[model samples]
Target: MIISRTPLRVSFCGGGSDLPAFYREHGGAVLSMSLARYVYLSMHEYFQSDGYILKYSRVETPKTLGEIEHRILRQVFEDYGIRGVDFNSSADVPAGTGLGSSSAFTVGLLNLCNAYQGRYEGRTTLAAKACEIELGKLGEPIGKQDQYGCALGGLNFIEFHPDDSVTCESVPITQAMRERLEAGLVMFYLGGTRSASEVLRKQSEQVKNSKRALGSMQAMVRQARSLRAEIMSDVDLIGPYLHEAWQRKRSLADGITNPRIDEAYERAMAAGATGGKLLGAGDAGFLLVYAPDEARAQVCAALPDCKAYDVRFDSIGTTIIYSD
Candidate 1:
């Protein structure tokens, strides 16, 4: 049996610019961090002679990629030549929650398959391969940030060059800055989850035509790079930058925010949060807030329907928990 664990990510800035539609022309960058929460994938050879057994929260079956009903899993297996294995996958949080859970799952599953095959590759290569599977092979309308963030955790700035070269840099934050960020940030569940692909597809189509949207995405990437520098020097400004990025992010897609999400944002702001935003593709999932310790109570009170969690930034990305 082989098990691989990959952390989910919270993109702090530069969310939309990583899409190929935007990056292929203007290049892109994203600043994000992984969390302790993870998607765990366990794969083992099935004693059964004929077929593959797959298990996840919603889908379970003894079928190959073509035979399975879940599109994501089907594509995943097909890309990896994973046929005739018993795969059981689960996560710390539910899927479609804008937490980059799907990418984490893909990374973890690939890691497990590599271990089973006795193939050793660095995190960057593994991340790139996963990106190839999802974006290149599967043709998913997504960006490179999620896979890279999940594979190489920590507070990082990822640069997507025009030539398809990806570079990961660690944010040089001081101890005091880390404390302030951990104390001030809060994540709350927004009562539902969403598949980011659906929203990203629309954004992709827009970027293929609208120069305005493409320009806006490029501006967001610049802001993200600037924000990373600020975070390393002075963490106090993250709140304002987060607000600025959120304002720009909402402009990328019309469905990025809804009444409920807007209400949550307003409540957090009213409760003394300096700023915050819905974490991923944004229709639903987790909302990240920057509230000082003293205002945490007020923030909690403001969002009655949501469950709040105090999370610290995870420095480790994906790893093999147990193998062989």
Candidate 2:
């Protein structure tokens, strides 16, 4: 049996600009961090039959890859020439919570397949293959940030170039700064989930049509760069940076925020949160708020309906925890 674990991600800024629709023309950059939460995959040979068995939120047994119902898994298994294995997956959080669950899954699966074949692949290769499978083969209208974030781990500043090349570098910060930043931030589950594809599809069209939104996204990319610099020196700027990013992000698409989300933001700010934003493409997901440790209680108390999730930064990317 071999088990692979990959961390999910929280995109801090530069959310929309990574989309090919935008970056292919203007290029893009994102700043994000991988969370301690993870998606795990365990696979072992199934010699009882000459077919494949898969299990996740559901179960599937297919004689051929063409018969697999899960689109991502089908494409990956076919690409890797994998068969006759019992594959099971579990995650720390559900999909569509804006934490890059899907990308975590894809990266983990790719790692598992490579390990199964007695092959070793580096992070860049793994990330690239995962991106090709999802963005190229699966045709998801998404960006490149999540795959690289999940594969590379850490707090990364990722750049997507028009030539389809990506560069990921660690955001420089002291351990003390990292700890303080993690402590000052809180994530509240606002309930419900959203389809990222639906959100990204709209945002992609908007990126091509609306100059205002496009300009906002460009400003956001700059914000991500500035945030990277600020966090290393002045940690206090985190909150205001999040505030600025959220304001620009909501303008990229319509459903990114609604009345309820707006009200929650107001309440959080009133309760002591200096700044915050929806973690993913919005609509629904965890709301990440920045406040001093002393103010977290007030923020939590103000949003009595939401649950505060405790998480820290993860430095390890997609890894095989067990192999035999």
Candidate 3:
């Protein structure tokens, strides 16, 4: 048996710029951090010799890799020539909550498959392979941030070059600053699950037509870089910086925010949240906010409909937790 665990991520700024539509021409960057929450994957030999059993929110028994209904599992199993195995998965958060759960799942699965195959690849290779499976093979209309974020497992500034190369640099934050940042930040579940594909697809198409939108995305990249630098010196800058990024983010696509999200943000701001934004590609998921000590209560009280989470940053990336 083999089990792998990976941390989900919270992207602070710079999102749309990572899409190939924009980055292939102008490059991109995102500042994000992994949380203690994780997606866990476990695999073992199946009792049956000629079939595979998979379990998650649902169960599937397929005689062939091609017969698997889950896309990432199917691709990973085929890539590794894995069969006659029973695979199970569990997570700290559900998918589509804007915490990069899908990428964490992919990274964890790849890590488990590598261990099962006795391959000792590092985080970089694992991230690259996962990206290849999701982006190059599956053709997901997403950016490279999540894969790298889940694999690297720290506060990072990730850069996506036009040449399709990615680089992750740890944010130079002091221990005190890290604690301060974590304390002031709050995540509230705004409900509903959304597949980022449609919004991302629309944003991708619009980038080619709207220079203004593309420019805004480019500016976001700069914001990501600046935020990383500024946060090291003063964590308090994050709130206003997040606000600035959020303003530009909503402009990239029409469906990124809806009436409910707008009302929530208004309420949060009224209650003392310095700034905040909907996590993920928008429409639904968690709403992340920056509220200082005095404002935290009011902010939480204002969002009566949303569930709150007190999550801390995680430094370890994906790891094989159990094996035999």
Candidate 4:
């Protein structure tokens, strides 16, 4: 049996710019961090069958890659030439929560496959292969940040060049700075979930049509780069940077925010959150609050319907939990 685990991610800035529709023309950049929460995959050989068994939150089946209907999963297995394997997958969080759960699952499963074949792939290779399977093969309207963030598993600055090359660098900060950032971050679960594909499709269409949204997206990427530098330098003004990025991000798509989301953001701010943004596609997912440690409890109390999760930065991206 072989088990692999990969961390989910929270994209801090430069969310929309990673889409090929935007990046292929103007390039892309993103600042993100992976959390301790993870997606786990367990794969083993089956003596009696020449097929695959797959499992996730609400889906379970045994079949070939061509037989599976889930676009991402099917493409991944096909690209990896995986067959005759019994694979069971699961995650700590549900999908469509803006936590990059799908990417984490993909990275973890691919890593397990590599281990099964006696191939040890590094984080960059694993991430790049996952991207090739998803973006290149599946043609999903998504960004590179998800795959890289899941594979690298830390606070990262990712730059995508026009030539389709990506560069990922870990953000360096002192222990004191790390502690301060952790104390100020408050994550609350919103009441619903959203389809990222639906949101991203709209953004892609707009960008393809030469809309102002693309320009705004580029601006946001630049802001993210600036904010990342400040955070790495241990600057105390990270909250305002988050606020600026959030304001620009909301302009990318109309469905990114709703009445309930607005109410939650307002309440969090009133309760002492320095700045906050709705994570993921915006119709539903998590609201990330930036505040001092003293203000976290009050912020959580203000939003009684939401559950708060205490998460820290995860430095390890993906790893083999066990193999034999």
Worst 10 residues of 4 by lDDT: 55-64
Question: Model 4, residue 107: displacement in angstroms?
Answer: 1.2
**Ten-residue segment with the worst summed lDDT in candidate 2?**
227-236
**Which model is ahead, 1 or 2, in terms of TM-score?**
2
Error of 3 at 307 (Å): 0.8
Q: What does candidate 2's lDDT look like per residue over 1-324, in tens digits?
A: 999999999888898888999999998999999999999999999875588889999999888878999999998888989888999999998889999999889999999999999999998899999999999998999999999999998999999999999998898788898888888888988888888998999999988899998899899999998888778887779899899999999888888988878888999999999999998888988999998888988999999998898769999899999999
Cα TM-score per model: 0.94, 0.98, 0.98, 0.94
Clashes of each: 1, 0, 0, 0
As a whole number from 0 to 100, the lDDT of residue 295 in candidate 2 is: 91
Candidate ranking under lDDT, highest first, comes to 2, 3, 1, 4
- Cα deviation of 78, candidate 3, in Å: 0.9
For candidate 2, list the clashing residue pairs, or say none: none
TM-score of 2: 0.98
lDDT for 115 (candidate 3): 95
lDDT of 4 by residue, 1-324 (tens): 999999998887888888888888988888889898989899888654776666665554655567887676677667677777777777888889999887787788789988988989899998988888778887767778899999997789999888899999888888898888888897899877777988988877876775677778888889778877888775456667677778877877778888888899899989988887888766888888888877888998999998999868889999999998
**Candidate 2 overall lDDT versus native:** 0.90
> Model 2 off-target regions past 4 Å?
none
> Each prediction's Cα RMSD?
1.8, 1.0, 1.0, 1.7
